[model samples]
Target: MNALFFVMGCVDGRLVLTLEETADMLGMALQTAYNQIDAGTFPIPLRKNGRKWVADARDIAEYLDLMRKEAREAHDALKRKLAA
Candidate 1:
């Protein structure tokens, strides 16, 4: 949880991140990150400067946590239902 909070607060005010950095952080392919952004599942980049797409690191981290929590809850609910 502290780690998550750290990532969320890393950028002081703006959550800035380059496409390559985000891909590395998320362990995803560079193109996959772009595709997810294109599909609107991921947070949108605030600016496109030249060949780069920059996103808010905080938003991305928070969004990732939200998705993870949702998935965990769903799986736990499923397990409970199966046990009952």
Candidate 2:
């Protein structure tokens, strides 16, 4: 819908994303995104351009795949715990 289009526009044909756009895409607060970047635990590697942080779409996709795997593992673990 309209929301989807808005999110898509956040990244251009170059696949570049600003810190705020990346935070919005990741569903986290802007401050939290900065913290994660500082801690080096963000979903993907970001490049610093002056005072802003930038992310690539390919990296974000990879991060999503990694998160999906972790989620599946956690779900399986919870099911086992409940069965026991």
Candidate 3:
């Protein structure tokens, strides 16, 4: 019954991060995140859980971290090219 406990990985169960959190973490729009889910690029979420889209928190965090690292590297390369 305690949603807050889920955020800290305290519950002995799977945690679902909201689409908004996922989007914010990836620095992307809500639609873009939905598209990835729709296109099967991102992990599919659980269904109709009373009104919220439910995705594994671990998956969302991992995907965002990976994408963030890649984006930063790409930006660095572009900066180097411009500086050269």
Best by TM-score: 2
Candidate 3 global lDDT: 0.62
Clashing pairs in 1: 15-56, 15-57
Model 1 alpha-carbon drift over 4 Å, by segment: 1-15, 37-46
Winner by lDDT: 2
Ranking by TM-score: 2, 1, 3
In model 3, state the lDDT of residue 14. 49
Sort all candidates by lDDT, best to worst. Answer: 2, 1, 3
lDDT of 3 by residue, 1-84 (tens): 233344335334447666776566456888987888788775534344677666666665555566668899999999999999
Q: Report the alpha-carbon TM-score of model 1 versus the true structure.
A: 0.65
Q: Residue-wise lDDT of candidate 1 within 1-84, one digit each (tens)?
A: 333566645545345777776676677888988788888875534568687777667656766787688899999999999999
In model 2, the worst 10-residue window by lDDT is 1-10
**Model 2 scores what on Cα lDDT?**
0.75
Report lDDT (Cα) of residue 1, candidate 3: 24
